[model samples]
Structures are given as C-alpha cells and as structure tokens.
Target: MKKYLIKKILSNNVVLVEKNKKNYVLVGKGIGFGKKKGDFLEDPKEIEEKFISLEGLSDFEYEHFLETTDPKIIEICNKIFEMASSELKENLNPKIHAGLIDHVNLAIKRLKEGIEIVNPFLFETKLLYPVEFELAEKAVSILKENLEITIPEAEIGFLALHLYGGRGNNDKEDALKHSKMMNRILGHVGKKLEIDMDKYPFDCQRLIMHLRGVINRVEKNQSLERSFVSKLKDEFSYEFKIAYDISKIMEKALKIRVPESEMGYIALHLHRLNSYKH
Candidate 1:
C-alpha cells in the first residue's frame, strides 16, 4: 500500500495529493487506497528502492540506526529520524536509540488500525494495583527529556512502582519523603557540578547506578524496608532511556562515541545480575 501526504482529506473519502504535482485522489470502497502528497510514500511493491527518509529521529539516532538494522526498520526509522532534530540525535546512545525507533514504529503501527495493550492481569492490577499508569508515563517522558531517549513500555513499569509503594509502606507520606530524598541528593550533586541534576542532560544509566548504590547503603545501614532493593531494580529498567541520553552528554563533554546502546544494555544486565555477578 502506498501512502500519500494528505494535502486535503476531501469530502466523500477523497483527498488532494501531490508528488511533484498535485492531484485529487478518491478512496474507493471495496478497493482501499491510501495515498497522499508531500509525504514520500513509496510503493516498494511497485518500484525500486531509492533514497530513504528519516522523519523523526535525531542525528545520533539516525547515524546509529542506519549503521545497524535492515531496510524495514529503516522505513520506520526514517519517520523517527524525520521527527527528531539533529540536536536531539546527538544525545542518544544506541540502546536508547534502538529502543526508541523500534517501539515508536510498533506503537504507530498498532495505533493506526486501532490497538491497545491487553494485559491478562489487568483486572488484578486495577484491584490491588502497585503502580499507576500515569506516573509511569511521567517517568518515561522524564527519561526521554533527560536521557535523550525514551521507552514507553519500561517507563510505564518504572512509574508503576508507586503502586508497589516502593520500599516504604504504600503511603503518600512515604512517597513524598522518597521523592524529597532523591531530589535532595540530586540537588546537592548538581550544585557541586554547577549543574542541577534535576535539569542536567545526564543519562539515567549513571544516575540510576549512582542511585542504586546509594539505595544499597540505605538498606544496609538503616534496616530499611525489604522493598528498597526491588525499588532500585525497578528504577533500573528506566536506565535504557537514560543511558542513551548520557551518550550525547558524554560525547559533548568528552568527545567520544562510546557505544551508547551497548553501555545501556550492560547497565541493564548489571542491574538484573544477569551475567555480571554482584
């Protein structure tokens, strides 16, 4: 199916399209047609492959994406590349980069014909919920803005930690206190660097790693709740989003193309104790 950049979604399922020239296209019933203008819609089934476009991804993400992956991902990556600006791309690590492209493609595809996430335990989650979906979304956005990457799936889980009540008893007071604790530590560190951890463009990989380490101290020294380590682990999943951002910051600060995605995966494995023993 060839796509058209919608110049005008006409009345009676008709649209004005353009490809070098403008024309009105009719979407006939029983014979579906999706065409547009300005939108570089290629009929791979019709003609040969030519120049590919990156519509949504940043420069760093595009460079890494083009280096790896097949043309299929590229088609999707093109949209991502186009969507992102060069400045945004400069900050992504490959892992965050890869995850961003892959998930965005999947999300857009699913959403197009109407789709949704269907968890079997959705009812159970709603009943004795451990995490809030909204908070997870917030976490994911924060990860993207700060880390120069985004993973909608994992952040949902990370933010959902509020439902689990994260280490302390599941109470508002505890949540507020933990928020303050994390913020205070970040604030102090930010001050030393003449940067606000709250505002700095550091990846979550280093941030979470630092946080997880501090969490260990809390649990060990104070007989903190058993859930603390679990909380840290949950938060660790968000590192994928952050590490990608860190790559850019590192590149800017250190002038290095440090295999951002690889570092993110390494951090993930470390967090799960998958290969590297703690």
Candidate 2:
C-alpha cells in the first residue's frame, strides 16, 4: 500500500493528494476529516473514489476546482458528465466540471433553505435543445438517487443549457465560430470605417465576451424586451449602423431575426469601443 500526501481538504470526504509529482483527488467517507496538508493517507481502504489529474484533467483550472469543491459535488458532476457524454456521443467540457459542481452545490443549499429561484429561459431552452433537455431530465434522476434532493422541473432545462454549452465538439465549434465572427466584424469595421481595433485589445476582449453572450442568446432563440430603437439609432447613428451590420450577420448565420433591443445593447458596446479610440 502506497501512502499519498494530502495537499488540501476540500470537504470531510474529499482531499487533493500528491504522489510521485502527480496530483489526484480522492473521495471517501472520513478520508479528509482530521487530515491536514502533508498528512499521509492513513488507510487505502478509506478511498472510495479517485480522479487522476494527469489523465485528461491536468489543467490548473481543474486542479483548482478539485482542491476547492466538495468531493460529493465533484462525484455527482462527474457522473452527470459521464452519462451525458455516453448519451450525447461527445465529451463534456471540462470547464463544466467547475460550473456544475458550483451550481448543484448552491442549488442544494438554496432548496434546503426554501429558496425558489426561477429559470426564466427554461421554456426556450427546452424547446431549442430537446436532446440536452432529456439528458438533464435524466440527470435529475441521478441527483435524486444520490443527493436525495428533488429539484424543480425548470432545473432540467437549466442543466440542459449547461450541458449543451459544455459538449466538446459544440464548444470548439462555437469558439471557432465566435472567433470568426469577431474577426469578420472587426474586419468589416476596419475596412469600411478604417478603425483599427487591434490597438484596443482590452476593449476587443470585452466585445468578444459580449458577442459570445449574443451568440448564446441567438442560438437559444432568446430575445430582450423592446427598447427605444429609434432614439438609440438617432443618438448613435454610426455605432447603430455597425450594430445593424452585426445583426445582419447574426440573422444570416443563425436564421433568427435579431431583436432591436439586442441591437441597441450591441450599439452601446460598439459606441464604447469607438469612443475609446476615436
């Protein structure tokens, strides 16, 4: 039997361990209790679960997640991703590891405290992504079985959105699409308006994040409330035109009409970017 040094205790049952210069997360009842950093695993039999960090989970982000999150939460998150990967025929995004654990932990806490937060996008999420919705429904079963907690039906749709975004293929494709769209928009503005946004990398990054949210909303057919489109257009005509051009691209690519309110928001961001350098 080999002794593993405890690096951190995430919960009473979960500990980050280091052996032979590699990191592993161990989960077992009482495995982490009474343990401190540099303490050896007293008994191997106490180990109920282990995730090898060297294998497909070496990123510092995952390491930090394993170190900070509860073991049971991590276990449940792993199970959800395992089931989703097998059912959907795609690898779930590793980043979802953190998000799911954090979400489910808070959700369990919220329910225990009698909080009832509604998922506003539940209907659209279910309608737009039926397959992921089904997977999330099944996930609720796993939660009920293991966590012994009943989640709201709307939670299924919320989980579906998370799972859908975390699918590896879709994640990569969406990233590529986002990058292409950002470049196209910047190129269009650079060529048509002759503004070099490359000089403002921070502003460009903010715009990228904004576009990411826009793409996600468009993909899910989510729209904002009506806004003062005419006033916005009048006040920020140049930025609004750029926003309109972006709307055209989004409409052409996603086959959904871009909402004027969303365009107004985009124009606001565009105006900020334009004002930064002009």
Candidate 3:
C-alpha cells in the first residue's frame, strides 16, 4: 500500500499529504484530526477519493489561502465540488477550489454588509450553461442551509459561471473574460437599440445564444456563407452598422476576425430586437 506523509494540516477535515514526492490536499471528515506533520497514513484508500492534486499550483499561494480562509467556507466548497462531480459524472478542475472559496467568502461578507450583488450576465450564463446553472441553484441551497443566509440569484449566476468554467479543460480566467466580453457586446447592443435588455428576457436570451454560437464558430475558423449579406446590409442599415461595431468589439477581445457573414446573422438578431422595441 502507498503511504502518505502528512505535510501540513489546514483544518480538522483537511490536510496536505505527500506521496511519491507529489503533494495533495486530502479532504475528509476528521482526516486531520489528531494528525500532525511527518505522520504517516498507512492506508491510501482512506483518502483515495478525497485528495486534490496540488500539481501546477503555487504551494505558497494555496497554503496561504487555506490558512486565511474560513474553514466552514472551505467545507462548503468541498461539498459543492463533490455534488458537482457526482452530478456531472466527471472530475472537476481542482484549481477552482481556492477561487470558489474566496468568491463565496467575499459574497457572504457583502451580503452581511447589506451590499447588493448584481450579475449583468445572468441570462446569458443561464442560457449558455443550463446544467451548470442548475448545479449552481443547488449550491445556493447548500450555502443557505449551512450559513443560514439567503444567497441571491445574481450570486447563483456567478456560481454557475464558476462551475461551467471548471469543467473539462476550461480555464476559469478565459471563461470569465469571455462572459465579460459577451456582457460588453450586449451592452453595446442595448445602447444602439436604445432599449433595456432586462425588459425583454426572451430577446436577450436569443441574442446571447446567437452571440455564443458566433464566438464558437469564429474561434474554430468556421464562417457562414450567406447569399443575403448585401441585402441584410442594405435593408437594415442601422442594425447592420451596430452589428459591424459589435464584430469589431468581439475581434479585439477574442483576437480573431469576425466574418462578414457572421455580422449579417448578428444584424438579423439586432433587427429582431429593435422590432421588439417599437
């Protein structure tokens, strides 16, 4: 059996352990209880399923986070991760641990201070990742049950974004940047149409879905071939102009060129949204 040497105890339920010269954070109920550094865990099976690899992470930074963060918050994050893994049927990116804990801790602090949390991309996030959004809803319930505090829907949206970003090989920072760019593009569309998107949830959802698809297609170098590009430009000059501007915004943020055909599709969506305004 592989033995683990206790390296550090973060909490009664969490510990840093070393095996084969690699470190991992072992999380389980009472895993660290009555344990100290240099102690050997003879049975690897005891924490076989609960260890998070610390590879590719800064040890100092992670240790500092565990030391400073509330243990209750860490426990909650672990619970959420376990639930997500079970439901998604896959292991999540362990890098999200520290980030989620920090985010939740700050959100709780803000709530205590009576500061309102708002998510401008709530609709977009939900539309983009329905499964993650559902998981986040469950996470909100977990937070409320444990902390005795109500988590706002805005926070749920943020949580969904985090969960979605943690899946597969997704980079959390890149996911967040993509969401921010989508928000900015929507903001531009709202400004150009002189309408508040919040008032039209369906339209906003459609636009966001289309934008996401456009982004995926553009990143994969897939361009749509449309015969009516000139017709779209001539018929909806105003909407096409706004779409062109949005393409530029996307190009700058994504560092990829937005095809004119894609701009035509965007213009059609814009036209539909503008029609709803009148």
Weakest ten-residue segment in model 2 by summed lDDT: 46-55
Best by TM-score, which number?
3
lDDT of the structure predicted as candidate 1: 0.39
Model 3: runs farther than 4 Å from truth? 44-46, 109-120
Q: Higher-TM-score candidate among 1 and 3?
A: 3
Candidate 2: tens digits of C-alpha lDDT, residues 147-252: 8877899678667767877875455234334445555676676565566766766666666667667877877889876658889889999888888898888777
* CA lDDT scores, all candidates in order: 0.39, 0.71, 0.84
Query: How do these models rank on TM-score, best leading?
Result: 3, 2, 1
Cα deviation at 152, candidate 2, in Å, is 0.4
Best by lDDT: 3
TM-score of 3: 0.89
Higher-ranked by lDDT: 1 or 3: 3
Going through the candidates in the order shown, the clash numbers are: 30, 0, 0
The true-versus-predicted C-alpha distance at residue 96 of model 2, in Å, is 1.4
Model 1 TM: 0.22
Per-residue lDDT of model 3, residues 1-278, tens digit only: 88899988888998878889887777889988999999987756657877765555576876776666776777788889999999999988877766787789889989989999998777767766779999999999999999999778999989987898789887756766777887888888889899997798787778778888998898887889889899999999999999999999988988988889999999998999899857
